[model samples]
Target: MERKGESRGKTPRAPVTERDSSRSPKRASGLSREVVVSATAVKTANPLAEEFDLSASKSHGQEPLPVSFSSPPLLDGLRESVLQALGQSASPTPIQALSLKHLFSDIPEWRQYLLASETGSGKSIAYLLPMFHHLKKSELALPEPTSSTISSRSQRAVNPRALVLAPTHELSRQLSSFAKALLHNIKLRVLCASRANVKSTPRATFTASKMAAQFTDDADGTLGMPHLGVSRPVDVLVGTPNKLLEMARGRRWDRVKDETDKQLAAELSGSRSETSSKSPEPEMGLQNVEWVIVDEADILFDPDFQESTRTLLADVAAARGQPVPYTPDLLRSSPETSTTSTLTQNTPINYPFNLILTTATIPPSLATYLDVHHPTLTRLASPKLHRLPSTMKTEYEGWTGGNKDADIERRIRKVWAEDSIRSDFNGKRSKILIFCNKGTKVQSLGAFLEGKGIPNVALTKDSGARNFGNNHHLDGFLRTTNYKPKPKSSSLSEDKEPHVMITTSMLSRGLDFSPDVRHVFIADEPRNMVDFLHRAGRSARAGQAGKVVVFGKLKGRGSAKATEMKKKVGALRK
Candidate 1:
């Protein structure tokens, strides 16, 4: 039989490695003896560096994850249910198998939870499995409905009890679709922040394609609102942070009435004063929200977002004591608002919900902060099939000079010799994703790679019309523009599954790259704990094996500084 590590195909590559510096530090060569030594020392059965490329990852604080791991409660059953729903052909990959459990287990006293796993580890499924269970298994209730007594779509909500937040639009769209598929038989009304414009607004833009729409519709008109939707609440709900914030801040969400969204649209078209002046300010409606999930959690931990989240939580806590967080249009949308103006006159929201967060890689700093703020929060880690094993090759070439761009390119070319390329030129198709620290560096590298005949795509920050190309900050890109949208495209889903996706640190964690992405070339070094988490998590996921190669300054002034940072993180973890 062909060796497990044998090459599967061919992929064009840009020049690799960084520029030559004075001290091209001695890296842990992933050769025979080294592989043996590391394996002997390895604490767990995860793939070793001999098979995975992890020269720069030796210093990470992670404990290798085992193949068989257990989850908390209710989480395991939830995962099993989703797995069954997907069918046998759509089997759970190894990483998914490992991660699904821990992500779901409950922390009874804690108000928060966090997951740290790399891409291709079935991170999405981790949260989805449990959230679905929370909705279906939990006995919840929505607020009430208005307008036509015949009932509306959202009014069917057992009480539209939960809210989920995502960072990017593309991610939001991807997740909404995933939720729909998983809950095909259940009732789940998803209101995305990027919803269809009432007139033409990004905030109003909803992303329910035909099939997705089926899932968004509820048995009652309250499917999308607090009262009807909340009263008859659906099993689940998803939205973006900012958009949800705007909705919560605005008034109007009393109950689901006939033509509810339509009425709100007209009201939104008017001045804010006119909208809020007619109704009470919209606040948190968490009574029915038994489970609240935050996706792309690393991004949410940003100072700006964290502050906003605190405010959001405060709102959810107050919905019971305050009036319905509804707008005038919501009142007009629901004829009942005229009669039931207060919580005393209508259904009151009073209940606690579980909070769950998921991310491919989490920053230790942020994790520390969260722990400090929410003392009882719990953290879980997922396993990786792509480990830094010694059997895999590990080599480094350095460059030094005042002409930064030229030196870096030269170093990259030196490392991209014909030997490092895929063995089969025509049969093997490889995609590479380059990680860069600065936008300027990303631009330079992308331009150079394309110039050198490599079919590559660059994801960068938008510089006010200065530079652009499939760039997505936190609000995710549109799935239509991306090359890889569907997870199960048979064209390239098997062993040779790597696609080159160049990005900043944004694409680091919580992503899944099935069997194809065997080689991980890191142009940037993981400077801190969270950064390290993302880099190390990339290689092996879903039980399929893989490798990762990191190239950057690991010596001299810059490298020394990076070293110090690593040591500090190490001490903290201890």
Candidate 2:
């Protein structure tokens, strides 16, 4: 049976694979001193990496330093399910431990922060805890809506207490998974806008198609319902900007009702008992959101999403003025409590919700914008930008193979040859991640590897879509790290031959790869320092020792741009 909450379309089934016993393990090899020296020419380590002692020190390195708690400080209030989801690894990462201390510290008002941390430093968990903390507290303090100004159902449907905006569908889905874990066994409902329901072309066409589908009673019954803005009950919502706005505009719901209410009322009088008993669901909106988080704020503020982000911010800002509707029972029983000095109607509340923006990189314009809009934002930066993790051994080599395809094929062969030997001797599979600049290259290379009988997959933005191909790209690549294979899939089995993942920037940052990744092959040099850092970050994650190889021509180590980038990287390391 299909899961109750699963969205439309079928999830692709992963392929099966069998090992080739002909390959034998070879002795592990180390980089030559000359190659090591060249690679270090552009290495940069994050200055903040030294701030906290990775071994025994548990306190956050800050003014009001966090006292070492027996366990994660916020674990007490979190649901057991959430804790269970976190499992033994619940101990906070350095970034999470430090950010939580200041973010949740006692203050006069809600705190605003701009958090910059290294990739895979547990940034998601850092903000997620605080969001849940605030929402649980608010749910207790605030009464349910019962205002005659709007239907209780309608108000409840459209009002989301917490809003999280991500740049991509995959990121939003990732956030939704974490949010669900934290909300386990709780009354709250978390909604993630599926990419399938979202339309990007012809605004009018999108509106018409969405509304027509939603007006019916038997709509998919998921969050995608266009009329859901004012009708469905969603406490936490994670989505891309354009899709979010499509579902957030409550006025559209009101307009729908205004046009249909009369006809519906007439039909109710004439219809049979079963039909008459049914009523339209409430329209959805973002009326009383309490927290707004922009994950990957740098991407959210980028040119591609900037306009939609501005519109979303404007909508949330407008929703702020209207207070949360109160239940009649609470009003009658505790008028004084409702109008307490802290929450008095006369005393203006600061902007309706708390704002948190998180990213590894904050562009200058975004910095300027934050300075103006959220002047009080707590500036949190790792002592320096996160450089490559120390656990990774960097390597540089020039590509002597003629032509692009030849260079790529040669590099793949070399890595596979070395890894095969390591696998036989060490009994450990060497998961390799290869980086390419473009999607077509990734696909072509993946196809090429398949032809060579090497297990490989290509992951990109389109890979996450429903109709991109029949292959299960996202599912297959995600399992590469944890070794959790779907039922009857020999390819995902740990005993199966080690698989290689060829990808673009889509899998470069934020997304977690398997700790088993033994090597990262930079088929193409990153364009800049930031790209270099994120690419290198793909390996040596969570303190695991790994290797990184940047290939170039035999005469020259790496591309011209890569050489220049290396110098800047070397300076940062120095």
Candidate 3:
């Protein structure tokens, strides 16, 4: 039988290698674990207990966050599955609906140009369904082996053959867990690509349409270190762009053994031991890679991130199986393809690649540029940029005139009321995502929330609690340090989903948190239409209704866009 989640990305090492500026590892075990309890529990608190109510969480562990629904929905199985996997239930977002038809079939050719919907349209599911089906089918075809010993050292690894490149550690972690949950009872190899963790015994793999395994060193022992027995072909590898790029670069560690002279010196110093004379083996590195998934393409594929993304694309493609050396017509976009492009502006015979790029919005100019490099791209089209509902209310408070901070404070207090929010969470709390334009404003708002004695926290790029590795062109830090939030007496719990997370656009795209997110507070003015829509998409996710709260001053309030949105929805109804 084909394994449900066959390995996605695993390949042999290439001859050429490169290095990254911020090569570091990040551990996401801290905040991620608590999210389950906080998001699932119904604000279940043990009154006098400083921490959350563990018993309450267990009792309602299966309960989902409350998302508004105006009508009797038709999706029963889908809703149950979502709530079981993600702790929330709502109809498929517009993107999910649009992608449903595509997902029901095996259209391996239509993988590229998959920019269907915006931030909260559940695009994660759009691509994942096809990937799961393909992996499962691939697994079923292979014969059951008795042992994991590599018959061929060069072709040791089995299965793993896909790559998912998200923008942040949090998002990558979220995707891995999500896929793992869905592909349960199947053979799959999912790996993360942060330079932080060291792959002690890096296994080599040979496969097609997969990703290379990249491991990180973990001293805390929270994340289970995945063991590869078969020198096995890996199937899926997911990580941020920089970490994957570093793994693909395959840096060689120059290990020099301690000489016997040093042992003699240590003996003279009276601290030598007989066991200190063991021989050391040569250092090793990552191997072949295959499939590639730019999970959140919008953030990582922007102009700023082109260099690293391009470099990663070239390296991963160069190491993939078959299709041999560079050719004239080989370079093109083929959804999930990792080939490099062959041409550039004013340059006809540019480089070629099988790079698959997807996002909610793809401008004509950008499409043209990509066409120059990917002449054979199959640009998929959708009626709208995103499939999220427009019925969600959108409010804008501007500050073009005076001190808008006061106004913002007054409103946040009104909508996200401390007492009512707690009661709402107690009755049924929903995950809340808050967005802001600048880091300073995020800090200011957080401080205000604290000053008001509200139990809340803020997550920004520059939090003193964060030690990021590199900027890596991602909206988030390429890698993070041990610095995380000081464990709050009030942290997100499974039973009580993340009721509120003050953030930037960093949380906009990577992970999937839909209709369940009932409230969104945008504390700053959107710079452009793209920014506005991206921020707006956070409120009403999946098919659940939601409320959007924008913080600004009235003098500069611009509802022109909002008016247009209402008009469009109205036209659709008519």
List the global CA lDDT of all models: 0.43, 0.54, 0.44
Which has the better TM-score: candidate 1, or candidate 2?
2
TM-score of each: 0.55, 0.68, 0.59
What does candidate 1's lDDT look like per residue over 22-92, in tens digits?
Answer: 11112111111110011111132222212222221222232232222233443454444454444433443
Off by over 4 Å in 1: 1-81, 84-112, 116-120, 139-159, 187-191, 195-234, 250-287, 296-298, 320-351, 359-364, 367-372, 378-395, 400-426, 463-500, 525-527, 554-574
TM-score of 3: 0.59
User: For candidate 2, what is the lDDT?
Assistant: 0.54
Residue-by-residue lDDT tens digits, candidate 3, 9-58: 21211111111122111111111111111111122222212211112122
Q: Ten consecutive residues with minimal summed lDDT in candidate 2? A: 31-40
Per-residue lDDT of candidate 2, residues 340-365 (tens digit): 34333222223556777887665443
Which model, 2 or 3, shows the larger TM-score? Answer: 2
